[model samples]
Target: MILLVVGADRVDAGKTTFSTGLLERTGAVGYKPRAGNDFWFDHDDCRRALADGRLYGKDAARLSAAASRGRAPERLNPVHRLWQPSPDGGSGLLGRSDREFVVDRIGRDPEDALFVRNATAEVPDAVADALPLADAVSIETVAEFNDLTEREYVPAFDRLADEIEDTDVAVVESYSDIARPLSSLDPAQVAAVAAVEPGRVRIYSGDRYCRACEIASSSPRDGAIEKRVPDVLDYLDPLERVRLPPLDKEQRDDPARIARAYANAYDAFLDAAGRV
Candidate 1:
């Protein structure tokens, strides 16, 4: 069964916290299909990943640790984008204001590759040099990045999906507020969906959630245009809402503590997923 955890807020939606707790409770393997971090705001994490010759967010690391067998962060997160703030108060290559797309790490382990965007040159020299550029592919335009992702991302996601097929449960954490991270992930395979925020979680039945996604999505099922939380919420009401109390730093880091604290919420998620 696939239990999908998505965010309502664009940032810090507590999806990771909820997911780690779920993984600890269910012994499910965690998969964060896509993730990214800002070079300016998440400098320490970015530098730590660069030191290891790869890039992945702290969320992926946390999920990795919380999983049953503890997969590598790169494996748990197949696609990781590295972003930087544009210094001149302008949009960078991807056309987002005050932000630039530095690089994207796709695939995992021996098959992994990096797509370094032209914006890399504009970042700090230390970051630029530390990035694994030896085998990186340089992208010069938005069209190029699109074309590359169109060819790479889905295939890489599929490869990772194959590895987790044997597990009883796979917990997928979406990136940002994206309704679904990978277009290739079949909603039919999803047993339940959780839309998370700072202090609450809305649980949706998989079939109804899939219907909402289909109705709200303007693009075809295989298209690149990702639907957001509000888009789908317009079509369906959640099955239930579970309150999540704030956690201290120590509790947040301990999956068992988190599971115990949020047992009711986790139980609701499993019941919705038909696990109960």
Candidate 2:
């Protein structure tokens, strides 16, 4: 499953951690269009791929795809930097185009990948665009711009969930840590997460973690298919091939660590896929 993880502009909301959890839980491919956390696809990967491969488009896509599997250029790290606006002090993420670039090499490469501007809803759209078109995509919806929202993140999340329902999903994040089943979280996210890790501990909502110790026994979407259901399933879940997302031990940022975690698990998924 080529899932897109969307992070709102909050640091500790656990979007990356939740993505890591999803990757770990399902053992999916863990593809990174552009590195946000520790899992980086720096310029070197692009350069190396560009140098070694005849097809720049295919190879560049492959390089981004491979970062999650532990083999990528060194420059991939520091894919993005933290930048906040002056005076207002609002959050702004360093993009691939940032002057003091970290993932500058990507820009040097010919691929169309963009250094994400911020980890907001905008990031997901960019991620969706960069991917080489996958069967399904999973998006992690969280608060944007640190709105100090209680359930206010729901609208953005709901829009996201509505947009991607027909695409793909493995384990989607929900703010229902207490298992309240609030409408803020789409039923599909609840269904997807609940179905995948039935009766296991899952991050329900950004607010708290929910121990999914109780299986619904029936499908969360039991009654009928909702409107425009994406008709896609995470092919990687049943896949035993495990991709072990490489971890950068020196780094402390949860996003980076989660990226590596996803990469490691993705490598595991590849291993599992080999048997097929």
Q: Which has the greatest TM-score? A: 1
TM per candidate comes to 0.92, 0.26
In model 2, what lDDT does residue 57 have?
28
- Which runs of model 2 end up more than 4 angstroms from their true locations? 1-9, 31-276
So what's the TM-score on candidate 2? 0.26
**Clashes by residue pair, model 1:** none
Q: Score residue 193 of candidate 1 by CA lDDT.
A: 94
**Count of residue pairs whose backbone atoms collide, per candidate:** 0, 35
Report the lDDT of model 2 for residue 205.
22
Candidate 1 residue-wise lDDT, 104-188, digit = tens: 7887762456555564346566566876665678877767767877688768887777765555789999988888776666667
Model 1, runs deviating above 4 Å: 110-112, 119-121, 164-166, 217-223
CA shift of 8, model 2, Å: 9.0
